[model samples]
Target: MPERIRFLRERAAMQERARLLDGLVERERSRLESLAQGNASAAMPLLDLYSDSALSEAAGLPLPSILGAPADSRAVDDRWAAARFCMSLLRGRKDLYARFPYALSEAADKNTFLAWLQSDEGARSTGLTPASQMHVVGLFSGDFAARARQAFLADARIRQVLPHGLTPAGQHGLFGWFMQHVWSETETHLRREEVLWLFMQAAENPRMELARAYEFTPDWQRRFPDALTVFGWPEFASWFVRHYGADPRWVDVAVAPEWHEPALQLRIGYGARGAWSTKYPLALSDVGQARALIGWLGSPEGDAGLSATARQWCQALDLPAVASELLKPGVNIIGHFCYPSGLRVSVESIAEALGQAGVDTSLRDLRTDAKDDPHHVDFGGPEVHDITVIHTQPDPFFPESYARSDLAERTPRTYRIAYWYWEFDSIPDAWVDCAKQVDEVWTATEFIARGLRERLPIPVRTLFPGVRLTPFEVRKRSDFGLDEDRYTFLFTFHMMSVMERKNPLGLIRAFRDAFRKDDKVSLVLKTSFGDRHPAELQKLRDAAADSNITVIDQVFSPDEVLSLMNACDAYVSLHRSEGLGLTMAEAMLMGKPVIATNFSGNVDFMDDGNSLLVPYELVKLGKPIPPYDADLEWAAPSVEHAAQLMRRVYDDQAWAREIGARAKASAEANLSLEAAGRRIRARLEEIEALRRQGR
Candidate 1:
């Protein structure tokens, strides 16, 4: 009796659920019928009752029957009724209409849809919503053949709409179609506005085959004589010369009164070779354009390019004055200026110091890959300089990497210097060979200089690049999502610099061992380029998961980097080795206590008095880590020693402050811009004296 009672209750519950489902189904069916009858207001409530997938499945059958049925079978009124119902359904849920039930490839169905789409009523229906219009175009895929069909259809639609103006959706659809199909293939009669629109669109789109629109230029020029003003003369000239082979007509148009100012601006701006200082320089291939520009600047219009001060200084200088000024000697500090590497900072510091010494300096950014920090500062300089400082690794220091044909031709008398940094004890033979190409080598630390001097016959000097900190804003711990109350220890690095060398996993272990999850101290690992080494980054993340640790894989500007260092109470680097330990020095400059391994280039500035020097064991690398071979020896820092130092720094605030103050004094004295400037000036003077003696 008990079992039968239980079974009866279960059956009753199932029957009640079935009844509710039946009611829902009936209501949905009514909504679908209303949608089919062109009553969108009644059908809109159905969306809440059913999921998008469910409503799409239910409405799929009726939509195709109304729009895709054979045209001959339906009378004009019946066809209009079908079109209205289709419009209502589309309005109800426009996103569900991406896939149509009928074959779009079928001629009858396509014609039926196209006829309705082209009609006045169809335009009003689609024009009601951008989504509806977008869905209509979405029916045609963006494949080459599909694009051709869409382009043909758009030509007719655009021609009709050309009298007024295109809606945003229409413009978007037309732009898409034109990007894939050639503009010449369009049968629409070209008007001045239409030609200008086409030219501007093609010129702006990096993917567009701009050469296809070259035929329209003559018409554009004939219609609008100052068309270059509208389409930016420099950009147009770049394309014009690329396609038309340096025509004098375009040159005259470029230097015309209306367009001459902008062209002169481009001339005074840094050229394509990344030479920030050189005026009116172009790539070797762009010499024709450069020559034309030079010719124009040497003419009466040349005064437009010069500043008032320059004009007064030269007394309305003609070609000789311009030539003399353009040919003046300056230092070209070339490197990966855009990258967020230590090399970028080194190059920037060198440039700043040279500028301070009253030596004219120009920066050339050689990095071709995506910049790590888009907000990185651009230090503009000259097009031509006499001395070339190549701050890069020896492997990529060849002419092919830094000195392109154009740079080589311009710097025939350049005094080449390689400012290199290496962390290893022994130098690579290839590096030694590459060093011969430069007149001398400059290194930031005596450790690197000693190795180079022993190996190379040429001069190898220890010249520390200046360390200057000008933070944009004083960022608090809360700005970086760090706990304000907790004493934070920051470790910043770039994963592209090599994971094993940075040893972030070791830092994580040390941090975890040093404190508990509830500890009032926190660790923030500010790093970038971790995406390239997912496994290593994942390992670090897993190790720090249970601790008061935050891993920030991002890029920061130079100012932001200094601000980050300012936010932290103490900075830590458990690195196996360092080229110059730029970040460590930056932290020291910010008056933060630094806890780093007592090894490599950092040891030049870091000592027992100024910072916490963690003990390390010298060990040979068991496995090859690219730049550092298996046999090369590097410091293996004691994690226990680092952990103890971190705890001590957190406990001893007054002691930490004293150490930080000492660090600031040491960094300012040794790494100041003035000191670096003095060193660089004396060296440059020596080089100049030697050059004068005909060495």
Candidate 2:
């Protein structure tokens, strides 16, 4: 009878403890939410409560009753307690502000209606992995063992390293079952990755304060193609939704629906998917239009430098609050990247160039790809150390076909190359062989480098790829019969046979809004678009019906472009992510005040007081479209808000003039071509010295 009474009392006590723990969790969550909103009144009390509870938990008394009579004994109790502590702290607004100090901004500066919360966010520490979802899809797919038996796949040696599990039917039942999900590919790039790299990219993205929602990709993993999931795309899509929700398809394609059977099994079966890969700096390159090659090399910036998404992806892969200082390097790594592009620059030719420059650079050329022997590309000659080889977007025409090709055989020891943005998990077979002889790889940005560490069997550093700038051909005001004295704002948004990520509609809306409110400002736009997006183009034109805007959709010489940009009062390029924003930097160098949406490599240059930075807003498209699986919502500065930014610059001519002067000074000292060239040369020497030191 006494034992029964005691058991009842213990059971009651456990329930009470569980209730207490739940309350703590809720309290922590509330405090965090309040803090993020800068709502101190709400958070202050919660923070205090949290502190008190944490202290109590540390003592292991006043322990939630659910932990049972032995308060120190329950393993599960600790998890609940830890969750209450960490989650609440993570949610704190003050902490968020401290950690991401740069994330706050004014909505007016963002210039778009879509930019809401982002108005308060700025260039803080964000990177790829910080917003990635680590969904383990391969392990649960049942067909792994079967594919391992296939002759074609056996050579790649993938089955050995993939992290996953499958149903007991040996994958004969469900292939890569969505239910078999092991980790989120969204957490990092498609390649195996480490936390450091993923965090780097995530840190970069959110810094701009654009809004992109989130999306999920549900695939059926059979042994071949569908199974070869790339983490970068999904993560990118997620960021787009969160940071640049201007277009809506991102969610439909990425935010996966419930997992169904055998959906995407053909990914690898088609062979290497590199052929369909997007450009490295996808936002800048417009497809189908022949670029009017510009020749003038740009100058480097002077001295002063400073510091510098997704999803549920934002939720699931919340990277630990990274140190902002890490994002701000005392001396950033800046240089010219020689992507193994163009046969004109043979490995030997490169060697000659290096020799002429008085730098000792070795060379090595590996087949750009092994999938096709005829297209095999080989690099040899002066094997340079330290300087990463700029392997441009994969070329189907890469030279690896000749039986005489021995790119790898010529690889010089102590040299390394950078993998392009999309070249993670699926490296060319020859590159793998060459890696053994090479030293390091600056895989895209630092974010990708860290992510690559997890996916690759080798080591990689975060050396970002940069865009080159030279003077653009100056387009005189007379060329367009415009009054040179008017405060002309240059806008480049158009449509053509090719598609670029330039948001023309956004340009029109921004211009329309700005001009409607202020009459002194006029805009000159260089634009083009593809035939398919007629509605998009027409809508943009319609928006500009009441405005004094000159829209030209044609190729212009670099000199002409530069001259026009210089003549203009200011220049703007509001692209989402050009990997690196060359246009903005070039304009900055030309002494034009600039405005750009925060993303990609572009964020590398945009800084406080240098030029106007805009927050991204989230936009949603209801309909599903081809190339996009479902509707999505994203965030970035909107055209409405962009107009506001223009208004500020347009209204304040003196301020605008001052801004332009600063813009030029910043770019010249920090991001000029000459500066980058000098940096590259120094890197070569440094690498040589390190090699000599046997580092």
Candidate 3:
């Protein structure tokens, strides 16, 4: 006989065996049921659970004659309920029926098989464990899905591939693989419900087959993008539910991890964003069009469309109608203004500068509308702005904040721009991918731009940072509760920033070494968000011990902080690195001579003519510094040189005043609000020109 014929013969033999076994069990079950007819529980047992009714009354009787039944005899629903009640009495439980074996078979096919397995003759003949007996029940259930589960579980090839864990997730993976084989062999298209039923049955028990099925499936993530639209196609939907464990939702698609393929996740995010614009629709007939929309939405310009709100809007209208909404022109700075973090302050400074230069600018909090800070500015409506300035860290801002900002659907015509800042030489891999998603990338300094331009395949521009320092009443040492006549050396740092990189320790060490316990000079270490870094705060306290250092661990408002800075004789920073050191610039603007490490982003403004540059040797980082690793080298400021500068500045008041004046002049000339505004407006104009050309 041919191999195909032999295989068919084996399958047919198994089917015949199953049929014979089922018949024997059914006959024995019926005989036992007759013996248990007198039992009280058997008097419409299942029906009584719903409502008391006699078995005789339910059997082949009109439902209305029974208590609370529908009056109409033609009511199929009432008739079926009555029929089910009568059937449940016949289907007996262990104590309900005297002959439980017969009752079990009547209740369910699996129950009958289980009863047969427990019998002395059946147990001796089968020699099956309880788990094995359950497997057999699935096998003899007379359904392809049940048989498939048994065949897959029993297959030697499958057992070898099965992983140890039988978690629901593991079962899903196995089913995803098994589904491919099941679908490929299926002669007729199965309904989604039918496919779901098969999976539901297979997942009832853990067997080697599930692992085999999971291992067999190839490039499951590749099928995901198609899975969303191919809902009617049972195979795709089955695979999707198994892998993802839910119907495809916008949040799941937008934030899928690497295992799902970041590229696909990115496209899904884009597609989800684009679907909001009147130019785009939630549902597309063409797969190619859907994919294009996804990719477009994922881009920087379409970032606004990915929000939950955008999705809700798109769901209500088709693409044609959404596209018909007229667009407005003018630049909008969508950033983190709701908080008083460094990013928020930076964004506000840029926006204020642009306004000063007569540029039409507005502010919109992208991810959050949180009205926490008293200083947060309202930019009117997010819709009125045409050009978007995404002020954030590249990878982080894009993935978490910008991806859900929902600007694309709201202002689809706006030319989206990203102003990003990074401290280290190389950007994160995610950031590199994000750079291309926008039309142009802006950096605060050329130092930052140089690193980005070297790797990013996008237009990169340099825009210097601007500051709006509010003038506070010039307070004496007595005003801040400090001893009068003490020459205060102020060192301010935000605890939110990396304490090690900020090198507050270096300043503390230098301060402690330069000044004596009895010296009239005081070192004021003003830091905020101490709770975030309690360990660092403690370390600071320990260093300040036995010295004339006043550690102010408190959050001060803008004016209060300005008063503190203005009260100090000089501002000092012995930082290991900086990304446009904002405090140092602010100190310079205040005509206060700054002593800082002559390395990294601060090099953009810090020069020998205006500020004291501490000499340092390039040293490898002691530990992993996020984007920069142990291999990365940064300046380790000379503590000896810092001490010398501190003492020199304290002794020569006239020289310090002259340097502070020059520092102020440099800041006014280079970091003025007008200068940044001019550069930003020019860039926006270029972007607008390009947008017009593309149109």
Instruction: Please report, in order, the local distance difference test score of every candidate based on alpha carbons.
Output: 0.59, 0.39, 0.58
Backbone clash total for model 1 is 6
Candidate 1: list runs displaced more than 4 Å: 1-250, 253-315, 318-329, 372-383, 397-399, 403-413
lDDT of 1 by residue, 144-255 (tens): 1222322322232232321011111122233322332322323343211222222222222211222222211223232322223322334554443333223334244333
Residue clash pairs of candidate 1: 276-381, 277-381, 277-382, 277-383, 278-382, 278-383
Evaluated with TM-score, which candidate comes out highest?
Answer: 1
lDDT score of residue 325 within candidate 3:
20
**TM-score of each candidate structure, all chains considered together:** 0.58, 0.39, 0.52
Between prediction 1 and prediction 3, which has the larger TM-score?
1
Candidate closer to the true structure by lDDT (higher is better), 1 or 2: 1
**What is the clash count of model 3?**
13
How many Å off is the CA of 193 in candidate 1?
20
Task: Report the lDDT of model 1 for residue 422.
Answer: 88
Per-model C-alpha RMSD: 19.6, 28.8, 23.6
| Model 1, C-alpha of 326: deviation from truth (Å) | 8.9
A best-first ranking of the candidates according to their lDDT comes to 1, 3, 2
Q: Compared with the true structure, what per-residue lDDT tens digits does model 3 show for residues 516-545?
A: 777789988888889878988999899888
